[model samples]
Target: MISWQARALNLFLKQTVKRSIENTKDVNKLRFQMRALDKFVFGTSSNIERSQSMREGTLCDEIKLKFSNSKKKLLYVHGGAFVFKTPAIHNNFIARLAEPLDLHAIVPDYPLAPEYPFPAALDSCYVIYKSLLDAGTLPEDIIIAGDSAGGNIALSLLLRARRNGLPMPNCCVLISPVADMTQSGLSSVENRYSDALFSLDVMLYCRNLYLEGANHDLHNEEISPLFADFTGLPPFMFHAGSTELMRDDSTRLAEFMQAHGVETHLQVWREMPHVFPLFEQLPESKAALQQIVDFIKKQQN
Candidate 1:
């Protein structure tokens, strides 16, 4: 059964956030509104400590437990349809993960869309990964993670790393990833109304802005890792709401990866909002966070 909190949050998002997304046409305006909303919802203070540092010339917010001695790292890419940077909610989510899992989390403030599209974000993430390896960080000690558009970057980064013969990370975690840019997934149509956070129009708008001047179409492997070869990718844990417009992005991609002999786990929460774990108020969010922590721990062993 879905928790009451989850149900109430869904309604709230549908009525407020989703409506705002649908009504806003300009990307800059939408970004500004989202920033303000994130601040309002998540607030500015957090228990976890955050510091700024540069990796491969990319500025990143490094998060971890105080006095942490761990060598493992989590490279988290924030999702904003590839147009916005890290928001308060994402910061809190990363903090939550880093605290329990004892990981040194590095979230790169990568370039966004319409200005620096396509290969720009992917290239920045790849360089950070390489920097980790160069600094004597073992591939087995690192885990790459992201949500929504950031998930696209995290997965595509692995695909690119594999092609270049770089050792894969310990594993990957994706929360409601926008894996398929083509938006051809069945849920994209069937869940048009059920999805509380995203509408079909908003998804297409973001996709168009991200792919604006790129030579590749929506089907490009880098743009849509769902269609790419997953031959030697690392184990993956995917979380998505059953009602999400991109539900099949996680489901289909997981099935494909499993078929390729990659260890893949996909969890679909009934009637949950997209990236529901980002909402700390929901009971289901706590359960999902525990599952993610367990998944990462298991990968380590």
Candidate 2:
């Protein structure tokens, strides 16, 4: 059941985020608008101390959560259609995730598309992961997680790491991830009108921008990891809103992973929107987050 608060927030997002996305065609302008929306929706906060650093020459932000113990780390990739910076919602979410488990979340602000394009963001993410390994964080003690496009990068990062013979993380948690960048999934067409946060137009725009320089098939496994082999990946938990256009993205990825004999959990929340866990006001959001925490705990054990 959808809580009243969740429903209300969904409506508000339809009004603000949906409308803004529909009217904005310029990529640069959309980036600015999304950043503003992030502020408006997430509110201003000074709770988390963020520091600047360079990873493989790309600027990244390390979120210093007040409750961090550094015993465990989460490499969180932010989702803004592959362009926008890590939003305040993600910062807050990291803090919440850190509070209970004393987790430290490292957010790498990878270069965006149309400017840096496909492999740039992916390469940057890999650099960050390699740096973590070099710094002595055992792969078993690290977890990789991302939302929306970040989830795309997270999955691709795992594949890339495996191909490079790097150790796998303990697990991965994808929140409304875009596993199939081709956007050919059933929900891509079915939930087009219902998903308030994303539209097919928006998806195409981001895809084109990200895939511009690849000069290869957009469905290439490196581009749309939904096409990749996942034989040896770690356990995964995918959370998606039932109303999300990316609902099938999560479902299909889970199915593929399970087919390969990997432990996969897919949680579909009814009436929720994309990345619903960012809305901590919604009870559904809290419940979904707890599910992630539980999955992480079980993996650790």
Q: Pick the candidate with the highest TM-score.
A: 1
State each candidate's clash count.
0, 0
For residues 155-234, write the lDDT of model 1, one tens digit per residue: 99998898888999999999999999878899999999999988888888888788885567777778999999899888
In order, the Cα lDDT scores of the candidates are 0.88, 0.84
**Residue-by-residue lDDT tens digits, candidate 2, 1-301:** 6899988988987888787887456888787767776664454245566676776787766665564557688899989888676467787787677665557778887888889888889999988998889989999989999999999999999999999999999999999998887678889888988897877887788888888845668677778899999999999999998888999999999999999999999999898999999877888888988999999999998
Cα-based TM-score, every candidate: 0.96, 0.94
lDDT (Cα, 0-100) at 55 in candidate 1: 84
Query: How many clashes (backbone atoms < 3 Å, residues ≥3 apart in a chain or on different chains) does model 1 have?
Result: 0
Model 1: CA > 4 A from native: 40-47, 213-215
Clashing pairs in 2: none
